[model samples]
Target: MKTIQLFFLILIIVSCSSNKKISVNTSKQSLKNQQLIIDTDINTENIIVEEISANTEIRLKKDSITTVNSYITAPVFDSILKPKHDSFNKLLSMFVSKEGFVHYKDLKKRQLDLQKYIFYLGENLPTQNWTKSDILAFWINTYNALTIDLILRHYPVKSIKDIKNPWQQRHWKLGDKWYNLDEIEHQILRKMDEPRLHFAIVCASISCPKLLNEAYTAENLEQQLTNATQDFLSDSTKNSISKDKVELSKIFNWFNADFTKNGSLIDFLNLYSPIEISKTASKSFKDYNWDLNE
Candidate 1:
C-alpha cells in the first residue's frame, strides 16, 4: 500500500506538470521605463517592473524561473524564490542616510511605494534554484523593510520599542507564511549559521548596525556581510574595540553563541576588529539604546 501511494504521488505531480503550459511575453518597452536602482549590485535584467495585471503570469528573471498567477492566485508551493530588491534599494538609497539613520518623515511620505514592493515579495518568494546567499539577502531586506514599515505605521514615536509588540506584530504575508520580525530573525536567519548576519538585520534602533544603504545581492553578499561585521565592531559608539580591552554592544552579550560558533567570541572579534584582540582582554557590554535610529 505504501509503494502504491508513492507511485500515485509521482503520477499526480507529473500529470499536473504536463497539464500546465507557461508562456512569458516580455514587454521590453514597458521594462525600459523601469529605472534600475543606481547603486544596486544585482543584475539589471533580474528586475521586471511592469504593471502586470492579476490575470497575467508574473515571470521574473532572477537566478531561477518563478511563475506566479497573481495576488488572487494561490502562491507557488515548495520553493522560496529570490525577490527583486531593486525598488526597495532605490528607496533605501533615498531615505537612509550615510550614517544609517533613516529619514523616517520623508520615508513615510512614500510608504505606498514601500508597501507595493513588500507585496511583491509576498507574491514572489525565493525558489529552489536561488543560491542560499540570494535567499538570505532577500530575508535580510525583508526584515529591514518591514521594520521600517512598522516604524512608519506608527511614525512620530520616540522608539520602535514604544510601539506595542514591535518585533512580534505580524505585518505581512510572504507566500503562505505570515512572518513577524521575531520569526524571521530567530527561526529563519539565525538558523542559516552565518553569525555575521547578526549585524545585518537591524531592529530600527540607534545602536543596531547601520542598515546597508544598498540591497545585498548574491554577488556581493560575502563582502557585504564582512563589511557589516567590520563596521559594527569598529564603530566606537557600538563596539569600543582595542587589543587589550573591549567594550562591545549588548548584541555581543545577547547573542554570544552566534559569534562563537567557529571558536571563542574573541576569535570572531579578532577577525573584524581593526586591532587584534587579546584573548585575555577585559570584556564588557554597553547599554542598548532603544531610541529610534532616525
Candidate 2:
C-alpha cells in the first residue's frame, strides 16, 4: 500500500511538471511571434527622421520670412508711443528759453533714447484732448519724429529718397489705420491745410526744413506750424525760384500729388513766395544728400 501511494504521488508531480513545460513553450512562441510582427515592414528610423526634417524645415522657413519682414519694417519706435505728462510744459519751456532748436547731430546720437520718450508720449496720447488742432499737432509730431528716425537709421544715404520706403513690405499701426510711409506723408500730413507743416516735418537732410528743438503744443501750435512753413519756404537754401523752373527740395517732387490737392506744385510754391513766379514746375528735382546730419 505504501509503494502504491508513493507511485501515485510521483505521477502527480510528473503531470504538473509536464503542464508547466507546455505552458512555458506556448508563451515563448507567442512572444517570438509578437516580436516578429513588431519588426516586420517597419522603417521606424526613416519615419522618425522624415518627421524631424519636416518640422525643422517648416520652422526654418517661418523664421526666415519674419526676419526679412523685420528688416523692411523695422519698428518705428522701440516701444509703443506714450504721452509725457509734462509734454506741454516741457515743450513750452524750450520755446520760451529759445532752446527749441533740435540739432540734427544731437538728435542722431540720442535716437534710441528719444524713441523711449516717444513711447511715453504714445502711452499718454489716448487720454489727451482730441481737438482737431491737438490731433493735428500730434500727427505732425509723430510724422516728424518718425521721419527723423528713418533718416538717422540710414544716416549716410545721399538723399531721403535713398531711404527706401520703410513700409514697402510691412504695415505700421498709426492712429486708426495701417499706414505706409507713403500714405502718412501724402494722405495725412499733406491733406492738412496747414502748409507750415512743410517745414516742421524735417527729412533729416540739409534741404528739408529744420527740426524743431521741442515738440509742438496746442497752446502755441498754430503759430509754431505757421512759422515753420514760412521759414522753410522762404529759406533760400531749401526753396528758391529761377527763371525757367523752381528749385525746390526733392520732397516736393516726391509728393507732388499732395501739393496738387489744393493747387499745383507751382501754385503751392507761389502762395508762399514773396515773388510772383511762373507756374512752370521744375523738370528735375535735385538729388538728396543722406550723409549724417552732423
Candidate 3:
C-alpha cells in the first residue's frame, strides 16, 4: 500500500507541472497577438491621416493656382478695329433704341448693312496687341451683332429660341473658326471671370438685361460694366428686393459661381442693389422671360 501511494503522488505532481506550463505559454501567445493587432490598427490610422493631408494639400494648391490666374491679364493681341468700331456703333444706334428696344422691323430694312457689319467683324479679328478690355469689347459686340443677325434671318419669330438650337448652331465665323452663341458666352466671356458680363450680354429676351444703346468700348469698359450692373439690379421688374427677402433674376442662379467667386450672391447684389440685404436674408429666383425683347 505504501509503494502504490508514492507512485500516485508522483503522477499528480507531474500533471500539475504540465498544466502550469500550458497556462504560461497560452498567456504569452495571447499578449503577442494583442500587440500585433494594436500595431496594425496604428498603421492603418497613420495611412488614413497621411492620405487626407495629401488631398488637402492638393486642393489648396489648385485653389492657389486659380487665384493667381484670375489676376493675370489676358495675352496681348495685335489687332485693330477702328472701322469695325464705327460700323458697330452705326448699327447699334440704328436698331437699338434709346429705351433699349430693338426695332427688328426697321433693322430688317437695313439687312444688307447689318450683313456687311458682321462680315467686317469676321475679317478684322483682334490681334495679339489688344488689351484684355479690347478683346472683351470686340467679342461682346460680335456676339450682339450676330444675335441681331440671327433674329432678322428668322424674322416673324416670337423668341430667340424659335430657331431650333439657336445657341448650339455654329452659324457665325470668328477669325478662322466657326462659333455658336454658347461658345462665345461660356468658352470666351465666362472664362474671363467677369461676372457683370451676365448683365452686359443681352439674350434678346424681355428678362435679359437691356441692350445698351452704345457699343461696349474698351476705353469705357469698366464704367459700362458698373453701369450695367447698377441698371440691371435697380430694375425691380428683374430683381425685386425687400429687407428680409430678395428675388433676383435667373441670371444670378445660372451663373452663381461667377458672381460668388469673391463673396456670396448677396454680397454681389449689395454692390449694385438699391435695397440693403442682410447676409442671412431669404433668397429666391424670378421666373425667366424668354419672350422676344422687342
Candidate 4:
C-alpha cells in the first residue's frame, strides 16, 4: 500500500508541470498576435492620412492655376464711360433722322450740347485697361460724333471730300492729342481686327453704313454690331443677292482683306446674308453713292 501511494504522488506532480508549461506558451502567443494586429492598424492609418494630404494638394494646385488664368483672360473696363455715353445717346436719338441721316443744321443749333458730348469723348479716351469691345464702341461713337461736328462746322457741304483734307486733317483733339478721321479708322479701329466694324462705322455718305440712331454702348456692343451687320446686309439697295450672283457694297471690296482674314468673303457673308450664296457664286461691287446720306 505505501508503494502504491508514492507512484500516485509522482504522477500528479508530472501532470501539474505539463499544465503550467501549456498555460505559459498560450499567454506568449496571444501577446504576439495582439501586437501584430496593432501594427497593421497603425500602417493603415498612415496610408489614409497620406492619401488625404495628396488629394488636398492637387486641389489647391488646380485652384491656383484657375485663378491665374482668369486674371490673364478676363477683360477690364472703366465705369466712368457709361454715363457719358448716355448723354451721347440722348443727342443721337434727338437729331438723327430715321433714314440714318444727320440733320447738321438742327444739330448746329444745339452746338453746346453737341460740343459737350464731343468734349467728354475727347477727354475720356479709352485706356489700355479697357476691353477690346469697349475700345471699339468708344472709337465708333467718337468717329461718328466727330463727323457730325465736322458737318455742323461746315454746314451745307456737298460732300465730306469737299472739305479740304477732310479725312487727313487732324483738327480734332482726343485724349490730349490730335487725331484725324483716317487715324481713328485705319490706325486704331482697323488694327483691332474686327471685320464687323466695317458695318458699324459711317462716313456721312449714302454709300457708307447707316449711322446708328442710338449710341453704341459697351453693354450692348455685340448685339448692336450684329444688328448693324444684319441691317446693312438686308438693305437691298446696298447689297443685292440672287441665286447665281451677289452684289455687295463697295465697302466689302475696299476691306476684302478684313473679311477674308478668317475665311473666304463668301463664307463671312453667308453668316448674315439672307440669301444662301453658293461657294462658286459670282460677286461684284455696287456703285457707291457719294452724296450725303441726308
Candidate 5:
C-alpha cells in the first residue's frame, strides 16, 4: 500500500508541474499579442498623420493656383486694339473707359489688371506659323497699349522724363521681374529695331501720332506702318524736309539718340523721307505740344 501511495503522489506532483508550465507559456503568448496590437495601432496613427499632411499641402497649392488665375493685365485698348473674334477684348475692356482712359485708383489696382491681362494674352496668342507683319502687329499693339496705360494714369507733363524718378516704381511686374515704361519702349520694342514703331506708339499728346481707330493686323501691318510714317512726315506741323535744313518734330530730337545710334538723323530720315535734303543741313529742335490728344 505504501508503494502504491508513493507512486500516486509522484504522479500528482508531475501533473501539477505540467499545468504550471502550460500557464507560463499561455501568459507569454498573451503578452506578445498585446504588444503586436500596440504596434499596429501606432502604425495606423502614423498613416493618418501622413494623409492629413498630404491633404493640407494639396489645399495650399490649389489656393495658390486660384490666386494666380485671378490676376489680369492693364487694358488700355479693347476691341479697338485687338480683334474681338476669339480674343481677349472683353477682358481688356474691363480696365479702360469707353473713351480710352485707364482708371487711376492706385498702383495695386493697375498692377492687378496688367498682370492678369498680359498673362492672358501671352497664354492665348496664336502659336501657328505667323508672318513678320503678324509679329509686328502684336508688338505695335502691345506698345500702344502699354503707352496708353502710362499716360492715362500720369500725363499733362512736359515729357515722360518729367516724372519724379518713376522708373524705380514697379510698373509692370512680369515673371518675378519688374519692368519700367522705358524698358518696354527702348528694350523690348526698339530692340526689334523697327522704324515704324515711331509712328505706331503715341505719348497721349497732340504732337504724337494719332492713335489708330482700329487694331493693326498682320496682313496689312507693313503697309500700315509705312503709311503711318509717311503721314507723320508729310504733316507740315510735325516734319518738313527741305533742301538746306531738315525741319523735324521734337520726337526726332528727343529720340535722336535712337536714330543716331546706327546713323545720323538725316540719314535715318532720308531712308523714309521722300523730299531731297542735304546731310549737312542745320539741325534744329521743335517744341512739343502737351495738349491732350482727344
Candidate 6:
C-alpha cells in the first residue's frame, strides 16, 4: 500500500513539472513573436508638393476632385475621379497663341480661373491606381502651370530669371508640405527616365521648348512627347542641323546627359531630328534666350 501511494505522488509531481516547463517555453516564444514586428516613422515633411496659394475661387466640377488648400484641410466631396484636363485645355487654347507665346496680360486678368485649377492640382494628388503615364502627365502639366502661375503672380516681369530663385522658391503648400520647382523638375520628372521631358516642359522662356497649346493627357501622352521633341529639334532657330554638323540649343549642353542615356546625344537627336546626323558630326551650342515667352 505504501509503495503504491509513493508511486502516485511521484507521477503527480512529474506531470506538474512537465506542464510548467511547456507553459514557460510557450510564453517566451509568444514574447519573441511580438518582438518581430517593428514600427518606423515615415518622413513626409521632406517630400515634394507644389501649387499656388489658397485664395483662389474654386468651383469644383460635378463628380470631380475636392479643393483642399489652406482653407479646407480635409474637405468632403464626391469620390475623386481620374483627372480631366478640359478646363486647363480651354485656358491654354485661349491664352496660348499657335506659336506658343502666352498672353500673360490676358491670363492675369482671368487669374482666378488659373488659380482655381492650380489649387485643384494640389488637392488631387496622384494615387497608386494611376498609371505611369497618368503620373507623368500630371507632373508635366503641374510644372508648366505652376511656372505660368508664378509669372502671373509677378506680372510685368521681363524674364523668368527676374523672379528671385524662380525654380527654387516654395510659393505654396499641399496639406502641410511645401515643395518647389526644383523638386518637381529635377527630383520627380527628370528621375522618371524620360529625356523628351526636356522638350515637353517649357520654362516660360523663348529658348525653352514652346508650350503646347493643350494640356497633356495620359491617353495621348506618348504621341505628344514625341511630337514635342520632334518639333523642338526641327526648329532651325533652336537646333540647326546638317548631315555632318549640328548646332544645338544650350538646353542640349545643360541636359546632355539626359539625351545620352540610351546612346550618344546624336543618337537621341536622330530619333527626333528630321535629318540623319553623321556619327562624327561636329557640334556647337546656341545661346539660350531666357526672355519671357509672353
Which one is best on TM-score?
A: 1
CA deviation > 4 Å runs, candidate 3: 1-84
List per-prediction Cα lDDT, in the order shown.
Answer: 0.82, 0.58, 0.80, 0.80, 0.61, 0.82
User: What is the lDDT, from 0 to 100, of the residue 95 in candidate 2?
Assistant: 32
Candidate 5 lDDT for residue 68: 18
Worst lDDT 10-window in candidate 3: 69-78
lDDT of 3 at 10: 97
- Tell me the tens digit of each residue's lDDT in model 4 across 139-194: 99988888888877777888887888788877677755888899999999999988
lDDT of 3 by residue, 170-280 (tens): 777755689888998999999988898888888889999999888998889999999999999989989898878998899988889999999998998899888889999
Writing each residue's lDDT as its tens digit, candidate 2 over 218-252 gives 66788887777667667776677665666777777
* Prediction 6 TM-score vs. true: 0.73
RMSD of each: 21.0, 16.8, 23.9, 18.2, 15.7, 16.5
- Residue 120 of model 6 has an lDDT of 75
The regions of model 5 sitting more than 4 angstroms off are 1-119, 122-132, 154-178, 260-263
| TM-score for all models, in order of appearance | 0.74, 0.52, 0.71, 0.72, 0.53, 0.73
- Superior by TM-score: candidate 4 or candidate 6: 6
Clashes of each: 6, 19, 9, 0, 11, 0
Off by over 4 Å in 2: 1-113, 126-129, 149-183, 191-196, 242-245, 279-284
Better TM-score candidate (1, 4): 1
Residue 275 of candidate 6: its Cα lDDT? 98
Ranking by TM-score: 1, 6, 4, 3, 5, 2
Positional deviation of residue 216's Cα in model 6 after best superposition, in angstroms = 0.3
Q: On lDDT, who's better, 2 or 3? A: 3
Q: Give the TM-score of candidate 5.
A: 0.53
